[model samples]
Target: MKNIRNFCIIAHIDHGKSTLADRLLDYTGSVTEREKQNQLLDSMDLERERGITIKSHAIQMDYIYKGEEYVLNLIDTPGHVDFSYEVSRSIAACEGALLIVDAAQSIQAQTISNLYLALENDLEIIPVLNKVDLPSANPEEVTDDIVELLGCNPEDVIHASGKTGFGVDKILEAVIERIPAPKGDPDGPLQALIFDSVYNTFRGIETYFRVFNGEIKKGQKIKFVATDKEYFADEVGTLKLTQVAKKSVKTGDVGYLITGIKTAKEVKVGDTITDFERPTTNIVEGFEDVKPMVFAGIYPVDTEDYEELRNSMEKLQLNDASLVFFPESSAALGFGFRCGFLGMLHMEIIQERLEREFDMTVITTVPNVSYNAYTNKNPDTPFIVNNPSDLPDPSTVNRVEEPYIKATIITKADFVGNVMSLCIEKRGMILNQTYLTPERVELTFDMPLAEIVFDFYDRLKTVSKGYASFDYHPIGMKTSKLVRLDILLNAQTVDALSALIHADNAQNIGKKMCEKLKELIPRQQFDIPIQAAIGAKIISRETIKALRKDVTAKCYGGDISRKRKLLEKQKKGKKRMRQVGNVEIPQQAFMAVLKLND
Candidate 1:
């Protein structure tokens, strides 16, 4: 326990976290020369191609410091706001965090947010300046910013370049000298915190946990406190480059345990693991349940594969515990699940993962934030509406309250006006603004979560020229004038395309949806009228002109009268086809609604 140093690396996106992790792995001699690669901890191919860490990867390292062998458990976390839950889990399992700030970017929104998380958990913070090798890097200015933000002395701020491994040795020395070892009693009953878990087709479910008390041994019967299920510990091991099996993992150590529990529901992340025979009196706590901000429906491309889709989702949930979903059905898109995601990026990643990992082709409906719907009859109790179709009838709905978030944006001072206007256009209310420096500003706004669900981030990046960093958290729900905007193909309603929109912007958005759908949906034999409506009132409509057939081609030199007859006959056939034709909506149409501003 005295030799163990457990810590995690946290930062904003593209702040050299994984690069630094690779350097740390190399310095600690954790990996061989053959395994050296960029983003060595980011195992997902999607993560590699996109240059983002979606998962928190934990690995054990052995280092010799002061002629003594020290064990270091390092967890590299994702920098995106969408994966903050991953950072939180990593924080809970560790005693300290390496707060890495980019020399050029300084401290962005997510960097501050993640730092607050570590502070809340009372973890020791080590501020490290990365990217010192870049020509654009301003080590002195960033070091000053870190001093003001963290209030640490100038000398305490380590100057390091993850690119060239400069000051890499100093960072290791700081980890051992500053970050304290894990605290626990090895003699007490087993009390472990299940920080994360993963599914394996061959070995069942593998739970990665930190032992807070006693020890977990192979063949020991373990109990999951929250689920109240017991299973024999089939395998116990430390998480190395590969899982290295051990006879036992004692207190203040991080390791993986395989219980051979195939059921996903039984093995819950953040649950407590205890010895079944001598269970701990107090269950380990403090892990927060995931709060899903965006709700969308995921339906299989083929309706018969609904069960297979469900299985794929379960497997995904094992790795990403933040994903919340329940069975739901829609009139437009048969049976599916209504999933809750952290943000647009998380939702997109999950959809891509399902297709790539499980070979499950799925259709995602329009994404929206959850709303509280109050009715005239049941005014006291509010109905949580996740889908527009789930909203009660307009006449019965007394009022609707939509979720709001406190968004914090840090950008260059020159782009202040642009950021302000963008937020205001989305019905955002200004909270406050602070000047961190003469050229940098931090603006906070109270904005609707639904407003930023679409293209707000992209627009922010564009308006700020990629210098702005944004982060947000829910600030409770507020009553708003909202209405259910529905889309109709011909006279039939498409529930999957429907969305709950603010009454003020409903007409404009509806109009845009109609026009966008017109371009995406292919022109069929008959004209398809794409209509956007609020109840009986059709706010917007666009027509996809029918594909005209040259019925009079056979008459090379036809008379005017014969041509007129052929035209009239074709018109009649088109009218009949329009009445019975089924519109084949392409998958891209559903996603088009997300990028309306583009």
Candidate 2:
């Protein structure tokens, strides 16, 4: 086991973690020159388009160190806080973490948060300062910051520019040295962790697991400790490391296996897979259970494609375990699913993936957190609401509290004042401040998770000119003066996109949201009066003028098919819209309103 090193690359979003993974795959000769792929770890189209690691990817590479063959099992973790749960699941499959911090940017809030998660898991961390080739590189200072922030020896840091391949060998050497090899009774029962899975049209479902003890080979029967479902391992394979296909996987390896599991319900991420014959009494734990904090409803643009949407969601669930969905029935829209996610970004990523990969359009509801409404009829019963329509009566909600996050923003010294002012404006409470470098400072704050889930990051980036970096983790619920702002279209609630905002800024925020919605939703067949109000008082209003004409005059017989096709396309376009009694709203309207300034 000492010859095998399991590790994950951890970093904040856009800090070059995926790029480093690509370079490592190249240096290890995992990708042949003939079959080179750019950003090989980002297999999903959405991931490549967003330039973010939405799903964690695992790859195995054989590296020769000091004339000895060592297998380096690499896992790429999501850097965004929205998928922190996915990051945790990925971290569970590894024995150590390669802390990748950008040399030019220094330590970020996410860097610190991920470092703490690694420490909490008791995983060895090999610090790597990446992007050293940049002119603004400050490896030495960042190393010192790492030492100060984590109180760990700076000796573990390996200065290397993943782009230039500098110190790549040294980083590899440090992985074997700093990260301890897998230690378990290989001869005993086979216990593995199901960190992730994927479904193939031909092969059915393939689950990725890291064996904690014992050897699992092809044709061996295994049982999931949690589900008690048994299946034979038809094939054992490792990640191609540079491609999306499966290679040869073995013991003490981080890879996947085909067990002929059909539906995604049989095997779930974070479940325990074990040898059925061995029957170990003690099972290895995977990761903390990830709960979806934000909830929303998703409906197809065309109600006829609802089944296809469900099938797509099931396929997506094979790779993404954090996204959750349940059947929902709405009067305005037909049968749909109420989906839950980590945050707003997670919600958007899922919605976009469904549209792009499955070739289907969907109308998504506004994201809302679960709240416990106090009432005499059901005082003890906790009610979960996704759409504003599901919200209990305001009088029944004795006191409303929403989840908050302990946020930290790191930026250049020059923008500190402006950033602080913005934070305060969002009702953020300053927690602590420290110098990451002479020119950079890390400011910690206690802000509502809802605040950062919106345009806070974009605003931060805009204010700092894309120089500011931020990360946050849920800090539990906190009481706030919050109210539900119902978005009405012609005096009727557009149940698809209602927002709960703080009473103090509800007017201003609602105005901004309605304005963005007006811009996002194109002119409809009828003029739509978009209005935002709290209870009986109106705050903001915008009108989407009626569409004059969306079709052109043509021959009745010759152009019938073409004109009918165009009308059909227009009708299909309307199917993608959400009809709120008398008004029609597009899917992007909800997303654009949530991220108004972005």
Candidate 3:
């Protein structure tokens, strides 16, 4: 156990954490030249194409240092803010973290956020400056910044380049010398922390865990502390890039357990696993259930694919315990699921995975943040509403509270003014601003999460010329003047198109939505009226004119009375059609309205 090191790599997106992981694998001889691949830990195709880590992966490596064999457990974590929960879980499984920062880009928003998470976990942090191979790299200045921010010794910061394999040996030596080995009792009762899990079609639930006490072996009966369900360990193994069956996994070691439980509901992340017969009285602490922050409705393009979508979501939930969903029905969208996510990116990844992995076409409604609505009569009993359509009558509601987030943005100093302007437009309150370096600045703001969800990041990027990086965490709910904005297509309310907006910006947003809808909705046999309304009052309106037809074209020599009669008949027919016909809105129209930020 003294020679064992359990640690993870933490960094902002595109900081080369995966690249560093690949180089470490090579240095440890975990993968041979023939099998080496870029971003090996990112097994999902989407992850490689997008150049980001969407999931956390763990692997065991055997390294030799000074003629002594050492066991190293490397857990590679996602860098995106949307997967912060995953990062926390990964941090919980390790005793230390490698805080990697790009030498050329310096510190980023996620870099600071991830550093705080590592500190909160009480893990030893090794500051490593990466990308020194770039021509613009400035390792010295970056090391100084790290030392100032983290208050670490100047000599402690390691300068390395993951792309060029420079300082790889030094990093390994630091991991062996600085990071502490896992401490536990081998003779104690079996106690393991389940950090992650995945569903296998042939083997059922495969759970990844770190053994904190005692040992686990094949055929041993173990129970999940949270579920209180017991199952015989059908297989026990360690991951070596791939799973390799083992005789036993002892204390201070990380591995996977295959219990023949056929359903995903039986396995839960952050749950403790212990011996069934000799169970420990104390369960592992800090095992909180994942709570989703954003909600959206996802429906299959074809109604018949509903069952398949449900099954796919179930399978997806097996790996992603953070995802929450239940059955939902929309008159316009048919049967679907009301799904909750940690953030917008999390929602996009799930939607993409459902289509890519499950081969199902789906339509997702506009994303929304959960709100608290208090009734005038029952002010003490506020109801949580996930969908705008679920909001109570405006006259009966006393107040509304919307979710807000503490956003941290880091960018070039020249772009600070632009960033501030963008934040103010999104109703953000400046909390603090500090110059990290002469050329870089960090700004903190308290902004409504709903405002940031709609094209805020894109606008920030445009204003900063792609130099700004952002990360945010939910602070709490704040009382606000908010209202439910409804879209009326031909005077009929479309439930899926309804949104919750601040009252001050309601008029402008409604107008933009109406204009976008007019451009998206095609002309029909009758004129279709697009309207945006708040409560009983219509605030904005646009009309898509009906396709015109020459009713008197055949009356070349006919009398003016004949032409007038034909035109009158045509007008009456158009009026009747407008009264009886329903406007069919395209799916793109909904997406356009949701993306209307300009």
Candidate 4:
């Protein structure tokens, strides 16, 4: 175990973590020339196309240093704020971290946040200044910034380029030298930490875990500490480019366990794996449960496929544990699940994955943050308002408290005004400001979580010209003036299109939603009245006139009295049609509320 190194790569998005990882794999001869590719750890097609790492990937590499063979287990983690849970899981499985910072961009929001996460884990940090090949790269200045942030000596910072493979050999040496080997007893009681799992149709669920103590062998009978289920290990292996079957995986090693378990509910992340006969006395406290920041409803396009959708979600959840969902039903969309995601991007990725991976067609409602609702009868106890309809009656409700977040935005000093104005427009209060450098600034704000649920991130990037990086964490709830804005189509409320919004921007947002729906909803035989309302009062309204069928066009030479009688009869028929006409709202209209600010 002294020659074994378990570490992970941590960085902000597009900070060359994967590229550096590629270089490391190359140096270790982990991949052949033909097998080499960009973002090799990002195996999903969606991840490659989007140029991002959505999932944490673990692989083992062998390196020879000074005639001694060393085993290195590297876990590449996603850098997006929405996937912070992934980063945390990866961190819990490792003893050290490679803090990669882009040389040109210096230290950004996610860089600082990820650094803090690694620090909290008590993991050894190796600062690597990446992208030194870029013409705009500033290694000297960035090293100073890294020194200030990490409080490490300037000599300790390694200058490397993921593009040109500069200083790649030095990084490998640092990993083997600076980082300590995993500490555990190979002969002690078996104790393993399950950090991640993925479903396989052919082999069942493959659980990836890190063995902290003792060892696990092939055909061993192990029990999951949390679920208390026993299963004989059908296969135990180390993760390479492809899983390599092994006789045994010992302490201070990361590997996979397959029991051919088909049911997804049987396996849970953060569970401990121990020998069934000689089980460990304690569970592996790997990481805390993920807290979802955004809530939305996901329903099947065809109502009959509800069961299939639930099945697919269960399997997907095995791979992506951050997604939390529960059974729910909507009046307009029928049976669905109210899902909790880390952010809007996380929600979008999950939706796309459900379509591509599971082949499930789903309709997602407008995303919002969970709120706390207090009623007059139960003023002390607060009810969770995940859906807009979950809010109690306006008269009986004492006050609605919405979730607030502490937003950290790091951007160029020139764009400070643009960012501050954007935050203020979202009803954010400036908490503090500090100039990191003469050219860079960091702004902190106390903002409503709902305000940034929509286009705030997009708008922030737009206003700052893609130079700004944003990161946020929930700061509990604050009492606020909020209203449930419901969209009524011809006097009938469509529960799926309803949203709870702040009272100040409710009218403006309602008007925008009504107008946007007017453009998307097709013209029916009768005039479709699209109204946005609060309680019994209509707040904003837009009327989509019916396609005029000229009944009078046929009778060109008819008398005025005859025309009047025909018109009156047509009007009476139209009134009856309006009463019975059920509005066919397109899927786009259900998601139009998210784009209201745009």
Candidate 2 per-residue C-alpha lDDT over 1-598 given as tens digits, one digit per residue, 9 for 90 to 100: 7799999989888778888888898888988997567678888987888788888888889898888999888988889888888778878878899998888878777887888888888888888889989998877888888787667787767888877889888888888777888887777777788888888889889888888877778788889888888999888867664334343344577777887778878887878777788777876776766688788888887889989988899999888888888898776678899998887778878888888888878888667776544455776665655566766677767666677878878889999998999899888999898776678888999988777666677788888887778877777776677788888876777666677778998898888887887887767665677899988789999988766455746545674678878877766655444354355566667666766655
- Sort the candidates on lDDT, descending order: 1, 4, 3, 2
- Rank order by TM-score, top first? 4, 1, 3, 2
Listed in order, each prediction's TM-score against the native is: 0.98, 0.88, 0.97, 0.99
lDDT of 4 at 140: 92
**Pairs that clash in candidate 2:** 301-575
Question: Model 4: per-residue lDDT, tens digit, 289-312?
Answer: 999999999999999999999999
TM-score between model 3 and native: 0.97
Off by over 4 Å in 4: none
lDDT of each: 0.94, 0.79, 0.91, 0.94
Flag the better candidate by TM-score, 2 or 4.
4
Better of 1 and 2 by lDDT: 1
Q: Which residue pairs show backbone clashes in model 3?
A: none
Instruction: Give candidate 1's TM-score.
Output: 0.98
Q: Which stretches of candidate 3 lie over 4 Å from their true place?
A: none
Better TM-score candidate (1, 4): 4
